[model samples]
Target: MSSSEPDRAVPDPRRWKALALLCVAMFVVNLDAQIVLLAIPSIEQDLGFTSGSEQWVLSAYLLTFGGLLMLGGRMADLLGRRRMFFIGTTMFLLASVLCGLAWTGEVLIAARTLQGASAAVMAPTALSILVTTFDEGSERNKALGIWSGIAGFGATAALLVGGPINDLLGWEWIFFLNVPIALILLGLGPVLLRESRGERRNAFDIAGAITVTLALVLLVYAVVEAPDAGWLSAQTLGLIAASIVVFAIFAWVETRSAAPLVPLRIFRNGTLVGGNIVMLLLGMIGFGMGLLVSLYAQQVLGYSALIFGLGMAVMTVMTVFGSAVGQALVTRVGFKPVAAGAMTLLGIGCLLLSRISPDGSYLGDILIPLLVFGPGLGGCYVAATIASQTGVAADEAGLASGINSAGFQIGGALGVAICSTVAASVTGAATGTVAINDGFRAAFIACVVFAVLGLAVALLLRANRPAASPAAPAAEDVPAPRTGAPVHAQAGE
Candidate 1:
């Protein structure tokens, strides 16, 4: 038996209970994401944030979240998962406290930055613990399905609850609400979750960690600032150039390091790389749609922020619907076709929404596209996560999860920047509905391009997944690696 089989042999009955707690952690993170989104205008008014400075309130969190995720994932592997989870929650709670107490725009932005950093540590480790505890096959698959479904709810819960919370208790409650939940998790975590870590390696990859993290930060910052600063300006051009240099140095360090933070060899898996690529695009699609649609609804259609949140709830609900059916579709039709179809649906949905008019109502303009986008939105996330995690070894579970998570986090920053930049570029000397809708149309066109590219890449995931690995059992004749990454339906291959 392989080294990983022993972990499976001694099952932890408390694993399910642990999952419930982990889900709560995930729930709070997802909830926090949406709460502020709807409340941004209110937050800006209260804190005196100008429109230009206001974007930072959103981008700051994303910057830290994306930059630190790889490091966070590695830390989870080095430290214990339970320990990391606790630390993460505590930091998140403190950040929330600061955000609630914040009297200035600067403070609020800083608090949000800390919150993202905290979540970066907490988020991937939860899934690592799940993967470590559960065995592969229907059992692990089912757990992932449930996890995805809960994640969908966590993401959309803010839409359902955020509008009311912001209205009734004030915008501060969005952050304050996390206090009780975190304290409860802190109290119960030690008893509920098991401590798991990879074998301690000889030396920490300090150079590798620093360089890669710097590159990610630079990249994220470059995109975030490009819109306001002019994409071709020296500042934007220099930042992009520097990020490439720093990333190249990190790659060099990884190749030479005795123990790399990101294993250079892991990139050898085409499925892993492709899956992460698709994930990045998924990030663009998901975040881009949320921001653009919300803008059109409020600015063009004259809906209230609260009403818009509730309307967005419609999309979130559809996502849950898709995730529920995603696994079954993958099982029956295979990941490639399901994922391709899902992206196609997303593309078509974005294309349809680009037809919005000044006189359009929510039911007429927004509902159809959101409803069409819902299932694919729900299904693709789970599919991408599965595809990314397929061949990864037990030890690298956190790493895989972090990269997958980073794709979305970083994708958000890119999406906002790209959409904003594209939309803004066309608004010169133009005013009123024509200017704004012009930007929206241009941005949606970019989203459609991204969706199509993602669909094409999804096609590659099936072909690139190899038919054999040495560790794969000869008796069972699994086409993909049993211990490493595998095609979901490789049995037929």
Candidate 2:
């Protein structure tokens, strides 16, 4: 009998309970990320944050979240996912308290950074737990499908709730709300979730982690600052140069290290590389759309936070529908076609969004495109996730999952920075709503370009098939040698 078969045959109510717990945790994480958008005006009013500082409120969280995700994933494998999950949840809950109590812009930004780091650890480990618990079949697919669906819906739901919460209670309530949810999850997680550990003993690559994190931070800073500071400014040029050097060092270290943070060999697999590329594009497009559309709704269309949230809620409902359809199609039609088709639809949606004007109504200007883009992005997210892990060895699953999560997190930071820079440059301190609308139109055009690129990359992905590996003995096979003892002491190898 297959090793997984034994686990599958066991009637474990804990598995279903675990899935529910994780899904709620995921909803809270995603909600926090988007809920801030509705409360941005309130925050600015209370904290006196300038437009430039406002951007940092979002970017700081993203920077830390994206930069630390790979490290977080490796830590989960080394320490134990459930252990890491608890630790991360505790940190996140504490951070939320700090954010709610923050009196200054600096304090809020710092708190946001901590919140993002906690999210990085929690997000991937939740998915990893799901994968480890469920056998690869209908059950696994269904679990993942619900997970993906919640992710798709959570952003919009945040916007929907954010406005009312901020309006009725205060902006602080948005952060305060997470405390109860996290406490509940923390209470239940230990009892319901099973512990799993990676089989390989690898040393954590501290140097690689430092170099890569620095490189990404510098690169993103350069991209985001280039529009404000001239592209040829000394600061921008220096940061860009430093980024290249750091990345080169990271590559060299990974190749030579006995235990690398990110195994260089993983990229040699076509599916893994392709999936990461697709995920990057998906993040660039999907996140870019959210940032631009929210701005358009409030700044251009003269909508209140409440109305803007309502519009976003419409999009979230559609995204849930899209995830359902994508899950149904993946089994019968395969991943490649679904991904490619989704990208095409996403591009078409972006093209339509580019036509919005200052006078445009939500129904005419936003609703249709959001309906189309919702499903397209939803399908792409699932396909890229599945593709990333399709053939990964059990020992490398944590690392693979980390890279996948990092791709989206990093891509989001890059996308928001790039799109914001472009829009800011085009708008240029314009006071009129019409000028802001024009800037949003330009941003939408940029989103269309990204969607086209994503479509091209999606087409390059091969159809899903059984993976062949010399290292893969069989589903029931045990490791030839025990590596767990080494892993406990030296992580990220």
Candidate 3:
């Protein structure tokens, strides 16, 4: 950077090691987001939480995580990626400790909110680091494939592990499990993670951040509680309307601010936008399906948490294969076809799942659809990871990554709300279990619709990378030997 400074002779071979460290953190965060599925009943009973308050344990985390991701990402760009990583990991660690020790439902909810905020900072920064470190061809593809594979399976891993941990110790152990992992990452992160930041700098858009956060909180709360509140009730409608108004204000603020939290120009890229939309669709179906299927397993089939986890694990193994194959195929056929075809397969899987009967066996009902959908979901994630990170400049890497990940987080909450509400829409005097079964079927039907819509969007997307200002293609740096031709677009196809 200076005349006296000598250029380094050796490339950093430790980059991949850093990625592995980042994945450790991400696994814990993603796991925390979903592992509570099995523990919810235990938590409600132990902490004396009402049904209403119990649901908030999950919603609060989603609200903060989805709402603050852009802000966290922008801060990472401004403050330095490594710095943000440490801070985020520390916050997450502290929150996990508190969650494990929580004596009240309110305290647990508060701790979860902090954990979500910490995840918001860490997850995008981790992705940005990977984007900046790896080239966009086979090398980047390989790394992203692994990263996407981890993401697609992290929740299932949690589900599988949650049962054993909860049964052996308690639900608190689920949160506590993050402690050692967090400390280890914090210890290694400074040494392993290289520092990078945007070439440009500007004042923090605090107003935009607050506006968007408030909007998201309102939106998430309204959606999560809408099933019980009556979706058409004035309370639900009012919150939804208010959230829209706040979001409009945030969008306006972004346009006017010299340093916007979310750069609107990124949306112009059809491939990236399509990737994000599909990511949202995945998020929606993923969380919603988990809730429905797990409920059906536990309530209807009387499966234990361990059984639920193991069932999902079978699917996770298939997911790994899907992602591995997807990474290979994207280099050959491009992300567009992989994304569309994979999403269509998932849609069909959802359709198949909708036919599940109350008396269905695991092999016929659960295993069939899980086998059908696992690889599809894995392929979708791999395609999305590549597409989302493909066209962005180094400076805006965190922002782009945040938005893509945000789609999943926000979509999950909205999906759960909608599906849960729909599933619960049975008439009076119906058995509770019957209502739940009906609800799951409805949720699967909704997933089918969303998956179909995602397939359409993916099919319509362009494969060429959108032009990014201030920097060149990320793939240009590595110069890996081309197998046949350049895989995805670089500024132009």
TM-score of each: 0.91, 0.90, 0.91
lDDT of 3 at 461: 72
Structure candidate 3, residue pairs in collision: 423-439
lDDT digits (tens) for residues 1-493 of candidate 2: 5443444355346778889888887788777766887788899999999776887677777777777778787777766777788898999999999999999999999999999889888887777766666656556666766777787677558777888888889999999999999999888887888666575455677898788778877877776566667677898899999999998999999999887877788888898888788888888887888889888888888888878777777678877887788777766666678778888888889889989988899999999998888888778877777777666665556667778888887777667767887788788887798888888888888988888888788788887632322222112123423532111111121
lDDT over C-alpha atoms for residue 15 of model 1 = 68
What candidate 3 gets wrong by more than 4 Å, as runs, is 1-11, 200-202, 432-435, 464-493
Cα lDDT, model 2, residue 451: 80
- Write one digit per residue (lDDT tens) for candidate 1, span 162-188: 777787789999899999999988988
lDDT of 1 at 30: 63
Cα-based lDDT at residue 148, candidate 2: 73
**If both were scored by TM-score, which would come out higher, candidate 1 or candidate 2?**
1
Candidate 3 TM-score versus the reference: 0.91
Per-residue error at 491 for model 1, in Å?
36
User: Model 1, residue 222: what's the lDDT?
Assistant: 93
lDDT (0 to 1) per candidate: 0.79, 0.77, 0.79
- lDDT tens per residue, model 3, 20-84: 98778777878888888788889999999975789877877888888788778777776666778
